[model samples]
Target: MILIKFLFITAILYLGPVVGQQECVKKFMDLSLVKYRAQNIGTESMTGQFMASYTLRVLWEYQFNCSCVNITSLILGINIRRVTDSRRLFPSVQVFTPKGSQYNLVTGSERIIYYTTSNVSTNGMIEYPLDPPIKVTNGDVLAISQPFKKASVVRVYYINGINFSSSMEYHIGSKNIDTSNFLVSNELILVYPVTSGYCVNSTNSITAEFVKKKALEIQRSQPFYYLSQYIYPQIVFSCNGSVTKWIFGAYSMGSLSRPELQIWRQLGPNNYNKIGSSLINATKMIGSNLYEFIPEVPLQFQEGDMFGVYSNNMVNGDSLILYEQRESGPMNLRIGPRLVSPLSTISFLKLYQFTNDYPLVTVEISQSTDLEESSTTEYSGSPYPSQLISKPSQSLSVSAKWLIGGIIGAITIISLASILVLACIIVFIKKRVNLHNSTDYSIIDTRKDDTKKDDTKQDDTLIMNDMTSVTPMQDNSAYGSTHDAAVNENPAYDSYSDGTYLYMSNNLYATVDEVKQDQDDDQYI
Candidate 1:
């Protein structure tokens, strides 16, 4: 009965009010991660997207913890190819305390306790609930690892927008996650994460211009067909720095369609690659105009690098691309020297492929991190642009966090050892005290027995040897003085000849008297 009552009370205490609050919150609030899902609304999840995957795909999202909120679930859209053997895709999610940067996520003492769900069968989106929601505070990183093997293919969406460089990290082959192996792409994953509370909207606005040596030298804007991706191949070794704003022929398809700026770099002669990119929902105007954009994460460019424009929106291709005709014929926008202001340097002079009509474009470059940005609630409305997630300065530094953790761990181990040593000392002291007291008690008891023996013994009597017992004196007269002295001398009178020897030594010729006295005392005492 007692156990039953205790269990009933425990059940009431745990499951009762929590369920009530959850129901209340669910009924009253908009539970969807509507602010983060601003871009994917109305259209298919992967609309205007390029799908790419690696040997090992690991995406780490730096969740902006506006409030101490619980992430209830994630809406994941993964494409799984047919498997031949016993292989299956297992999509999993794990949470981590923000320690080091996302580049070093797999290193050090990691909390790798993962929650795995059943395999996603199709290429559709599914809301995998977090069974028990994972709570997150400010500066926490959420890791999403989709089950993938070499045989299976998973659709990874890549578009333009404000996102971290480490957001879409991939590891190749069976090797561990190395910082160098991560891919920096133009994919801004606005993954929808249902939160139990409100998350701040990520909206960004930047107004900057590209570099221009001469402002008055205007060029004609030419019309060109829009491709999925465009880069300035000829504008290599021109102006190199962080691009703040890019103006391509005053208005390319940028004014007609939404495009993300992709920064491509040339590491060696044949080693050209896309290093960074930005996604923004800049407004499309009616006529020719310049489009302004800002990246959430800062992008750096070298001296021999070029920038490009990308769009995942294949549905709208009737956009304008600014280019020039130096060979006396209409040229392709894929070919460089589009209407961009030149630095008039030796490298810029040798970069232009046309000498005739070329579309004029401008790009602004800055060496400092002083770009002004304004926020908005536009993420909930129009095509969501992008914003940089600012890290807190008040939080512990990476080195400080490591030091404090080491100190705490050392202190814990030392404390446990000290407790064990103290406990052993206490036990030893208790046992020593018990043993000392017992020894004292034994000595005291033995002394008490010796004292009683001394009290019964005569003061002048010297015990030459140990005796079994002493005979008590008689109250009535049983013998003469000689018999009394002889009886007193014998500690125990037995039928032995020691007393006879003593009597003969005291009186040599008194054998008859001694024998008569002994016979009188006892026939065989």
Candidate 2:
């Protein structure tokens, strides 16, 4: 048992890192440290003409919530417009560490680590994957910057006053020059290698408990470039539920006094009454541009009520709230683009409630026994409550479908090729058989002609033997005279007398009559 325990401990020691790595991979696939939704509501380009030496830079900072297991890549949304075919642009990414205060513009170590160049025309969000991943840990201050070198118009999606707590800062300048936060917008940039391989220790942490829901609504508004000393924009939202918390994004100068966040409820169309008021305080700044405002006391709101957050600051400075001109609010107070607009257009806000109560049901039951004893019981609520269903299985991805189709297509092509080869083989076999049959017929005809010639030669040989017999018998005089007389007296001999002739040793003689007479006499004998 001691040996087994030792072996088991050793196994765990060896497998712990492996299991951690697997969990890290899963976390990387599902989590993101920073993400900003891109919008095409507006675009900013280089104000002047294109110059090869000219460079534009934008800086942003992000704060991580958890210790990063690994940082594999960085993604930024870029828009390239009116780019010519012959023109090209090289965009480089730089990361830095903050040097001084978290809310100030101080940077320390800098690295020009990643760079990419593109010539293809692109209009909207384009992703650039970093080759070498950056490693980071918890609470690491990350400052990211992008420098573009080209004549083409390039735009990055941004929100105005999106980061107010100084968590994010933007600076624009020439290449290798110090940047300033003059006209910088909150850029949509993201870093990878999110929280993984870590378990949540507590869900009731201060930040998690306060913010239960993510920002639900984002209204896109134009950047408020001009600042007025006594005027501020009012933002209205139609909301429901007893709001326990309110968050707003804005941009302000650090020297300005705290602004008042006024909550208003709509009585009728274009009529709003102030309901609740809270002094705006910066909770957290996501990036250099976005600022968060959380009320001290949770404001309660009814259903279908038009609510609004109005900034009461009356100072004209570089600090201004960003809003879009889109038609989104249910009611409007100001008619035109006055000093104080009725509604600030594009803003990000979240509403949360801490306690939500459900209705209760009670039941009572009474039972009586045959022996006259009775009992009463009470039941409340549910014995078995329904749980939320798990998510359905995901369908096959595009790459998987393409792979299956390619395999099927290859099989079909092979089948067609095989059938074509088989047909060619069959046709060749038939042609060979036809050629062989024609050759056999020619051989048979030659053999028949040779046989006929042999029979004719045999007949000619028999005739020659008869002629020789006549010549040999000519030496016998008595026999020859009697044979001659016999041949001439025969009536058959007359048949040969007209043309029968014999030639021997250059001398010609008419012996056909004798020959015919001899033949007739021989037959009779």
Candidate 3:
């Protein structure tokens, strides 16, 4: 029983750390901090110790663990050593292609050879990506080396392929220098230092005077002729170098302004080799310090983040409450490019109002008199705190005006469209009514004219037949009188065969008939 208990305890202790480490690895992988953290490990020189270990495939998979083994606040820069040896020669011997015919080796017998050093510790050999794979040994002809340094007299050379037998003897001065086996080429190359600047020192506490002195010294070192003789004539620092030394040595002279401290904090006692290092440092330092007064929340802002300020006691007409989220964290609000101080409450309120009463604010942490123990303070607010106030952007009024104008324009367009549509509808209705009225008139006129024309034609035919019958009875006076009486009965027919009268009457009748026919055709079709 005792042995089993001991084994169980041992297993628990052993597995606990393994499980925790696995969890850490999982978190790091999910975060993608491997590459990001590795890049920041050693900015200038490899000071921070980092080790990554991959657990070999056990049952089915592989796992890894990456961690920082050591942490230091200081990063130092190391200078690169240049090639100083003098025995090396320049420009390898150039040999023309072998031919039976005689050819002169013109103007290339004697030449200067130069060499250059690379920051990479290896022989500076980078393998090329091959298209068609070529079978070669590991120690194959990688690339031809160039001169390590260059002078007015020095030059460079290149050779392809490795010397297999007698590799050492094949160097510079050898009897059997098989130049035929190696392909030779040469070109001029430029060399620059890997590192141009170095960090001198780092401390948590730095005075403001030291920074100003350094700045002044840098100004003095600039072109003196340009400073004194030409422009900036009022500048008179006769003992410029000596004065700089005394001012810098004092270390107790410059002002401890907010901007200067912010600059130092951003530098963060770390190595900075890349460009914009100073600006980055300044921003970071100021931002981190500002975070103390600014509340931490998921600031839903794109034009940088947002921070707020608060003061229980404030003076009138003083710029006090000032806040801005310049970067990721809260920053001191700027009034026309000048930083507002926290002590000035009135300015803070004005700036706050200017920024639309941004409500994300933090409380002033109370100081503890006892230094030995830590204390936690509670405030009367929700988990996620905020000081809400109503103040919309001034631009919102302009936006509202634009919105109203758009609405008005849309309404006007719709009204005009409706009026046009109504007019078109009325015109269409009027045209339809006119067409119906014209058709009615044509039908009435055609019916009346048709009856009159039929009656006239019958009358004319009857008259002709009567006249022929009466010619046989020319002497009969009774028959002639009877015909005359019948004609007189219908006195409306003044002429039965008058061509002018008949033509006029027939044309009027034909016009009426044609109109009626057109109406009928329209209905049929």
Candidate 4:
């Protein structure tokens, strides 16, 4: 019982440092700190609390919730706590391909690697490095099938809480797992998963400041000239991973308040679309004429990604963002000019390649963080001990803005079509109103002519009434016939200053002198 207590304390010391290790995958990983944990299955009450012993064919299986592409785990290091200290029998280390739910039916690997209890050294973790690295697929499964007798009992640790842990289940001796009547545990496989994500001798990853320094050094060393034309530049990345840095050459281009040119993202061979405004805005100058774009949240790309920049060729030397035009460069770097065209056209990324000086731009790539820690189902999110789970990127990324961009374009087209229909309706209504007003005006003009004729008739009637009201003196001339009877009675004579009387009879007006002269000559007689 005293020996059982010592092993339990030793297990805690081995795993305590895990809390203080770097949260992210670093350039180098320790082999001892990077493998998963198993539960202690001993029946002894005191011993079973910290360490578990295999009761016959008990198989410990754990599953990852992600698909592994360029990721692989080469070393298998385990801390076998306690055993009989001398025995021929040991546990079987095995691998299995995953089907549905990671806990799915397992199709075992080609060969099973065995670990013997011949040298039971509890000083530290035991290491086994495979000659060929393990091939990983989507939802890969790693298992340990324990095959031992009662006296030859060996114990493994059942860690209650830790990072990079997978959900564990108890299975029979075979590699295959049966879902019916299966049991789960309060514990998880505690692991410090280290990978070859970044190597010590790797030259693949770099920073934006480094790229900027290198390009400036090249410019000063050799006599370099700019591409003397307004152009859109493109750099086709040959490496396959998420691009973390994009450095543009610095020049005396006057300060721009907004993005002068467009930046585009290429997902596939022919797929091209405008990236978010966050990427193109280089208004934030770190120092002098230098311009660099570093996103607050970086996106992952499994691509030979190509990027393009559009600028005005007619602008002055101080107008556009400048990059060194290199006559000769790394053979891996393939860059040229991409003419601007409408996004709807298939000819948008017009790989209209040019053969000479290339843009002195820098690009770098890194492995995805998807290999960090997968989601745990049965053991995770439970209200047990919350402080143990290290969920750093627990709440972000995997955004599909590219799909969203296509949806927005479709909405824009629909909006334009609606506006066009509304315009046509307005034009049609305007024409109908104009035609109605023209017809109404023609009828109004005819009514005005009739009104003028009626006015003339009224004036004529008034003149006749005035003449009929004048009383005329009765004519006594014998020559007067029926014409004299038609004369109107004269009211009064209007005399003038010359003593001439105005005689108006039968609608005829005459002066008094003319009437008197006629009487004097006996015209009446």
**How close is every model to the real structure, measured as TM-score?**
0.24, 0.22, 0.18, 0.23
Off by over 4 Å in 2: 1-61, 66-68, 81-91, 98-125, 146-154, 161-525
- Model 4, position 268, has a per-residue lDDT of 32
Over 4 Å off in model 4, which ranges? 1-245, 255-289, 296-300, 312-318, 330-349, 363-367, 371-525
| Model 1 residue 46 distance off true place after TM-score fit, in angstroms | 7.4
Better of 2 and 3 by lDDT: 2
Writing each residue's lDDT as its tens digit, candidate 1 over 1-525 gives 343344444434432211122221121112121111221222222222323333234444344457577777665433322221222333344444544433323233122112111132111234556756766666555555533333232333333554433433443332244445455444444244567776523323110111010110111123322333444543332322465554332233333444455666543322336777665443533223433445555576543455555433323553443332111111112323232321211221122111112223334455422223322111111111122222322133223344555565556566666877997899779767744543221112343456454332343222222342323323213321433222100111122222111121112223422111211110111
Model 1, position 50: C-alpha lDDT score: 22
Candidate 2 lDDT, tens digit per residue, 1-525?
343344445444432222121221121111111112112223322121111233333333344545554344434333332222322333444433333433222233233322211121011122333444445444443444434433323333232323312222344332232323333333222222222344123211212211111111121223322221111111222122233433333445553534444444433222345566555555565444444445555554322223333333335662434332221111122211122533433211111110011000001111111222222211121110122122322133223334444565556566666877897899778767744543321112343455554332321122222233222323324223423222101111112111111111101112322111110010111
Which regions in candidate 1 have their CA more than 4 angstroms from the true location?
1-62, 80-86, 100-125, 146-150, 153-155, 160-185, 200-525
The number of the candidate with the highest TM-score is: 1
Q: Give the poorly placed runs of model 3, Cα more than 4 Å off.
A: 1-341, 344-396, 442-525
Could you tell me the lDDT of residue 251 within candidate 3? Answer: 11
Error of 4 at 135 (Å): 43
Lowest summed lDDT across 10 adjacent residues in model 4 is found at 487-496
- Please estimate how well model 2 matches the true structure, expressed as its whole-model Cα lDDT: 0.30
User: Which candidate leads the pack in lDDT?
Assistant: 1
